[model samples]
Target: MKNLKIALSLLILISVTSCDDFLSEKPDNRTEIDTPAKISELLVQAYPQMSYFDIAETMSDNVFDSGMPETLRKNEQSYNWDIQTETTDIDTQAYYWDACYTAIAHANKALEAIEDLGSPASLNPQKGEALIARAYSHFMLVSLWSKRYNPATAASDLGIPYVTKPETELVTKYKRNTVKEVFDFIEKDIEDGLKIVTNDYKQPKFHFNVSASKAFASRFYLIKGDWDRVLELTSDLGSKPVGKLRDFASYDLLSAVDQRLAYASSDAETNLLIVSANSIVSRSYYSNRFYLSGARYPDIFGTATSLFNKPWLYNFYSSNSSITVFLPKFYEYFKYSNVTAGIGDPYVAEVLLSNDEFFLNRIEAHVMKGNIATANDELEYFLSTRTVGYVPTDKLTEAKVVAKYPVIADEYTPFYTMTPVQTSYVKAIAETRRRDFIHEGMRWFDVKRFNIVVNHETTNKPVNTLVKDDNRRAIQIPLHASNTGVELNPR
Candidate 1:
């Protein structure tokens, strides 16, 4: 159901001691240790932690768009503004951090209770599941709230606390571990969990499974730019037949509710990790905006008239007036309901890492190693698959891309084409990545990684905004962590 509220309630019940008072205080019936069933129930509490996924996705996109008013959303789009110094107070970052830790605590409690079950031979599959789940929750926490791992800086950089126990001990003071240590702990846990959890459990339709762990590994390797490991993990995924990519061009925007909903509900072949739609908005955000006539373009979803109005059908005067109409970005992803619903679950698409991305990575590696022809071939492969119209050659030298997208080149000065082979390769890979994962929370990270200059209208003027070295890169660590002696990342 991807129901986040249920997830939150269950988490609080299992991990927090304050709620223990609500339990019946019959002295004779009270037990010092948790029963197996009780522990299993606690493990179930981890479900709501997926809410962090929705929060991360929305905040990453909505907070960065210029179309939304600052007053209406209030620094939601702006990152690391001086006025909001206490990073912990930021809703998006705070919510994600809290949700992840809560889930981790529940997993820890489950594992501790399993050990207390005594005989190792009697251990249940649920115990291993809990271990893997805890490790994954922690992995996401570090990636989202902290800086990218650098061995040199990791010892000084604060990572989330590695709470392996329920912390029932009174006066238990927690401390943050180094980023490197945290990742090391996570990797070890995953390895240990893999040993215990066999591929025998009936696959839960909307929960984490063994394959999901592999998917996570693939993503982790990709983030670290470990091309060989990325290839290995993704190849493992390709061996298992799962899902397929949906052709975006085939969807009809103006259809009946049931028809539209059916199309929306259909999962894209490549959808890897998603939170459940039922856990977030009640209906599609775009659909609601369109129906209410509250849509705007290049901002939130645009106005309904701007969306459906046909300029060719109108008179010359009316057509001239309609030229100013702008299409909304929201409609690009959310035109259907099914797609919205499948937000939280670990989907197959994420596991099937793109062949295009793989070649791009290979090309980049070659360029770095000074293998010119190999790099050029990889670059051509990527660009050829990107569009149906154009086919690039191995010998295609870098030239100004002014012929295509002439308006952008004309409007913007010094708009150079792919001048260097390395530049061409980077651009080709980045563009493919963007098109492949539109709402998957990869764009802003890409913007930062490539150090791309963001040229867009701030207040309807062509303003060139450089996001490089921006304070917005590191999200504010949660206040709860800070209060508990966990150090915050530098703002």
Candidate 2:
């Protein structure tokens, strides 16, 4: 509650026109943030309204949007794998370009204000927060609008400009940094920012408090293939004593408010960082359009085709009779008065980082480092929590894992053929990440990192296929971003 107190007050600081170029306008004079407290007020405004789920989740294979309405053009275009599915509304934009830069602008504003305060230790917290915020915003923008971070080609590949200062003009323009430069800038900010960010906040989950900051570090290190740093940074799991999965069987899904608990902001056990999300995150309308594909559809109910045809449903779920539906990893009941009566909620809060992701991060790091037994232990612990009565027998022998999940061998390409032990652990990490982060945009991140091939031929419409390294993976920069000489990502 205290987090929102300052956050909500300064949320009105977002005064830029959506249609205009990012950072094209200046903030109003009365709203100038001048002090450390005022910087916190403005820094909290650094989070974007919409997440990657609002835009690029369609590019991943987790969705089945055949059920979506024809009127939702952005969703439709993205579903069909259009490289340039541009939306006219900045508020509802698919790529979230304006929203990201607006948050960056806020972070820059906070950093600029702090610079004039005699470089005091009292402002370090705000300074640290602004640095991470700025780094995070640029990271998201670069990941979305530029090529995937291929180290060899990164110096040549285009990346989003890392904006550090507040904009002052109506037509300010910038150039794209190379992917390697973007990575350098983000790493520098995070490495320094984490050192300054202390565990001192009323609402730890809402702000990037110690736990969330470490989790962010883990993600950054994992992306960089620096596993040692990832483990070291996350050794202290901030507030949670144990990273346990939420037992859905104990939940009262029948109640709308109770059902929402899975993603509620106050839930500290599962989530490391909780932030306000786009209204589209709701289960209402386009939310549940998640197409449970033939390759990976856990049919808890007697629904569609699945590799686990027999009693696999009951094996995972302790009780599915009460709740006949299981699709999105996080969901709630919706009330559509004029449309189909019962739907899903459109107001679920977004989870930025979570314990489950860390668990997987550990598993991957350990496996890659040849700590096979430890990696298997991490996988077993995660499974025992997620599935009912899941017991590890014989340290999850690779042969046994392949026997149960042969599809994993193919889904995890190139190195999917790793010796049974390592391959099994990698597949386990991949599957858990997918299942845990359904509808949360993490799958898209995985898709980019893994270079997973995504084909959109599920619907009756024309089929669209994108193999690894396809240009579609790099979402197009908004035409307006090119305004005033800023270069557009090549289409």
Candidate 3:
């Protein structure tokens, strides 16, 4: 019995160590977090290292089966809407899930330290950052793992556990909160955090600065059907966000590598929050079988698809095959642990929040508020930035929007009600966003929120369809997490 107990204890220790947060590192170093500077440094890890761009993008309507021979299980699984079984691989949902909680742990530790130090007024910024970081991670967790937030059903929907405190026990089991409970917690954190959050960091873009905080809040409220709050949060960004938006026209001139780096660069005014994500998605540009291929590329990027009847200003590069094509958004920066061996981990600078998205959220808010003219104007201005040879004459009208996106009945059914005109305008905005954030994995959230059906075509097999309100819309909880007593989303 003694020997068996020892063996089991060792097994548990190994499992704990293998987990993302063993809670014994620099960020979680309880002793080291005695000072403010250390706490600030700790909060750096508060942003998730994992990338959801690939997973989300694949699951959305943006990518198609290229019929390419090269295969990545994660990409293929996501494209088919299958439960992602790969638990530890970068760019997988499970990795992202672990990454989120690992990030939350860092935030929780920092908050605990602040409380331990008597919660000085000087530590307000740190406290605010920590709270918001916690909220952001939890928000992401629920957004991806739980059912889309429906107010009527959210109270009963399963949410990822909202972990607010540092783990004191090694094998602490967690239970899933309901969607409403999770949102309530996230709202409380965001509200508390925003009240005291500051853009005081040396490199503010990497952190949840004032703009990033508002941008995040804009998305949260946008999902919650709080149109007025979304509009208010993003009000300062101005209707014509010329300088704040991405300079896609100039980006078109840069080299492919430069374009990749520039898209998520701190130098770019649009990128509000950037994180160095531990990801291999950039490398998957060509190797993955499921990808943005020539067949689907033209329909997405063609002039006919654009309301302005012009080519998009996006920088697209074809792989060596000229078969698997992709946008130059995610650029991998490798960090070598052993220089002599040429071994390293791949990292991509991912834009978590941006002014471009913030502006779109504003435009959508306008549409929801029955401000059709204002929404049209803003949408025109936003698209002009990304349209090739965009002239002032290329205008946007409700007529054009309706013609472009003639509402199919029951096509888009969000929680909020909309007029037929409003629905058309919203669909137009969604299409624009779908193109804008092609590789960013944001489209998946929209797919969930709008309850849009998706069809995936395979060369040999029959078409796989994800119908509206399909239970599979909520990605299954990671197996490891579920094994630890967290309930899985219903299949």
lDDT digits (tens) for residues 169-278 of candidate 2: 65568888898999999999898788898667776776777667777778877877787987787566422325454554444243333344455546547677776654
Instruction: State the local distance difference test value for candidate 3.
Output: 0.86
> What are the runs in model 3 whose C-alpha is more than 4 Å off?
1-22, 25-32
lDDT ranking from best candidate downward: 3, 2, 1
| lDDT string, candidate 1, 345-407, tens digits | 221112223333444444544544455565555445444433333423323333422221123
TM-score of each model, paired residue for residue: 0.61, 0.81, 0.94
Which candidate tops lDDT? Answer: 3
Question: What does the lDDT read for residue 193 in candidate 3?
Answer: 97
Model 3 TM-score is 0.94
Span of ten consecutive residues with least summed lDDT in model 2:
1-10
lDDT (Cα, 0-100) at 48 in candidate 2: 74
Q: Which regions of candidate 2 deviate over 4 angstroms?
A: 1-30, 65-71, 83-95, 237-245, 252-256, 284-296, 299-347, 391-395, 405-421
Instruction: Tell me the lDDT of model 3 at 21.
Output: 35
C-alpha lDDT of residue 121 in model 3: 95
**Tens-digit lDDT track of model 3 for 316-364:** 7775455667777877766766667867677778999999899999999
